[model samples]
Every structure is written in C-alpha cells, then in structure tokens.
Target: MAAGSRRVRAARRRQRRLAKGTHDLTEVQWTALLSAWAGCAYCGAEDPSLQRDCVLPISRGGRYTLDNVVPACRSCNASKCNFEVTGWLRRKQLDEQDFLLRYAEIRATLVTDLDDLDDPRN
Candidate 1:
C-alpha cells in the first residue's frame, strides 16, 4: 500500500477507536507488556522493534487497551493485519492454545499490578 493510503487508513482506524470509547494504552503498560512478552506473541521472534497489535483488530471494534493489545514482530503484525488472533495463528501454524494461555496469564498479572498502583497502600 502507498504511504498516503496507509496514513489515511490509520487515521480512520483512530477515528473508529475513538468512536468505540477505547482506552489508551499507556506507555508504562506498554513497557510492562513488552517486557512480559519479550518477543513476538505469535511466533516468539525476539525482534527489537516490536509493534503493538490488536487481537480483535480496530476494524472489528477492538481497542488499543492492554486487554486487546500484544507485542508482535513487524512480520507477524503485518501478516495478521485485521485477522482474528486464533484463526491467524492457526493459518500461520503457530500454537494458538499457548498464545491464549500466556496472554491470559500476562494480562492478569499486569492488571493486578495496575490495580496495586491505584491503591493508596502501594
């Protein structure tokens, strides 16, 4: 796709996300997420430049929040563009079950950490 086309698509995606009232994924959360994953969430590639990929996709009303986002290498992120996570994983011959399980565990831990940060005692 042309650069202009990509920019336009990204702008539209941002509009859609705003319409859905999706929460922003903060830098702190993103850092923790990347640290937790430590590689491509799909293929386990230890790429230094990981991108934030939406599991459900913005086209499907997916948010940019922690629950919907994960670290993905550029290749996997581009290949899985706008596709459902499990189906894309299946097509790529990756372990869908493992991804789901790990995602759940990581999300839970991150959420708990966030909650603790919100607590006064913390």
Candidate 2:
C-alpha cells in the first residue's frame, strides 16, 4: 500500500474511534497534554480555560492523535474554524511572545498545582 493510503486508513480508523466517544485519556493525561501545548496551536492564547482543539478538520480527515491536537482558547478556536495552523497564524499575524508566556505559565501552573490535584473539591 502507498504511504498516503496507509495514513488515510489510520485517520479513518481514528475518526471512527472518536465517534464512539470512548476516549482513553484520564484527567491526569489531559492535564499533561494541555500543559504541554500551553494554548491553541493556531493563533496563541494564554487563557486558563483553554479547550481541546483539533489540528486537522475531523469532518475532512483528522485524527485524535497527540501530534494533531492542542489546547485552544475560545476566540482562537472559533476564528480558526476548520483552517490549518499556518493559515490561521498568517491571517492573525500571531506573535511569539504570547506562545512563550503561555508555555512558561503552563509549566508553572502544573508544578505549583500538583498538590491541589489531591483535593476533592478540585
């Protein structure tokens, strides 16, 4: 099989898996993943309540793979819609400082809040 065909097949399988809504990641996993990305992969935002964002359009052909996903703020996620990261960033003229700040905060939040995870109210 061609490399392209294999990738398409894998993506299709992934899409079906997602449709079943049986995500395997635990809360800790989600925290770690989101912390790594800091914010949206498109136009960067450093909001604390960033939502999970898909890199590729699921309707077209996107997988839930870690490599193709990131946490995204509401504004950036909406503006990005179904576009690619490069297009979204170019259209918005996204700055690097925002990303840097987000990354730094992401690290700090996780480390500082490590003890809070044990709290039932959290």
Candidate 3:
C-alpha cells in the first residue's frame, strides 16, 4: 500500500475502535459530571435527566475521552444525537459564538490527562 493509503487504513481502524459505546465513565469523566453540578453544560439547565454527551458524535470518529464530552440534559442530548456541537447549536437557533465560548469554559474546568478513547473499565 502507498504511504497515504496506509495512513487512511489506520485512521479507519481507529475510528471503528472508537465508535462503540463504552458505557463506562473514567475518573476524569466523573469529575466533569460532578463539576457540571448535574446541570446541562450547553444550556445550564439543572436537570436530573442529564447525560454525558459526546461533543463530537461517535459516528464522526469522535473519541470517548474527557475533552470530547460534556454534561447535557436529556432533551438536549437526545436532540443533538450525532450532530456536531456547533451545528446542533445552530440548528437549535442558539448563538454559536456564545455556545462555543461556554463550551470552552466548561472544557477548561474539566481538563484531564486521561486520553484513552476506549472504555477504561474494559
């Protein structure tokens, strides 16, 4: 295979590996969840039905890592299924710039050294 082809294959393999749902939260993820104060990271809604959502959907090769996730309410999370963060915000008629800024702030508070994409519990 050509060098470029090799790289593409490797990337595909990685994406396939990361597409599965781990259903396990790392310590870092736990910290992010707690730090969100059980509220939606996107809208600041204090919802008991909150869920950890992938900012970049898994189908798009988004890794299930600390940096790629945020706490979101069930409504927002379900509505955002497989949608890119910015796109979802736009579709919801939200201010993209403001949402991105808030996302940045939320991410900053939940930064972690753990970079594993697969479930750690596995």
What tens digits encode model 3's per-residue C-alpha lDDT throughout 13-35? 66676756563558657665546
Residue 8, model 3, lDDT: 100
TM-score of 2: 0.53
For all candidates, the clash counts are: 0, 0, 0
Candidate lDDT (C-alpha), each: 0.91, 0.65, 0.72
Angstrom error at residue 41, model 3:
1.7
Off by over 4 Å in 3: 1-25, 112-122
Tell me each candidate's TM-score.
Answer: 0.86, 0.53, 0.63
Which residue pairs show backbone clashes in model 3? none
Q: Give the CA lDDT, 0 to 100, for residue 94 in model 3.
A: 69
Selected candidate, larger lDDT, 2 vs 3:
3
- What are the C-alpha RMSDs, in order, of all predicted structures? 2.6, 8.6, 10.0
Model 1 per-residue lDDT tens digits across residues 1-122: 69999999999977876687657899999999999999999999999999999998888888889899999999999999889889999998999999999999999999999879879987
Which ranking of candidates, highest TM-score first?
1, 3, 2
Instruction: Quote the positional error of residue 82 for candidate 2 in Å.
Output: 0.5
Give the clashing pairs for model 2: none
TM-score of 3: 0.63
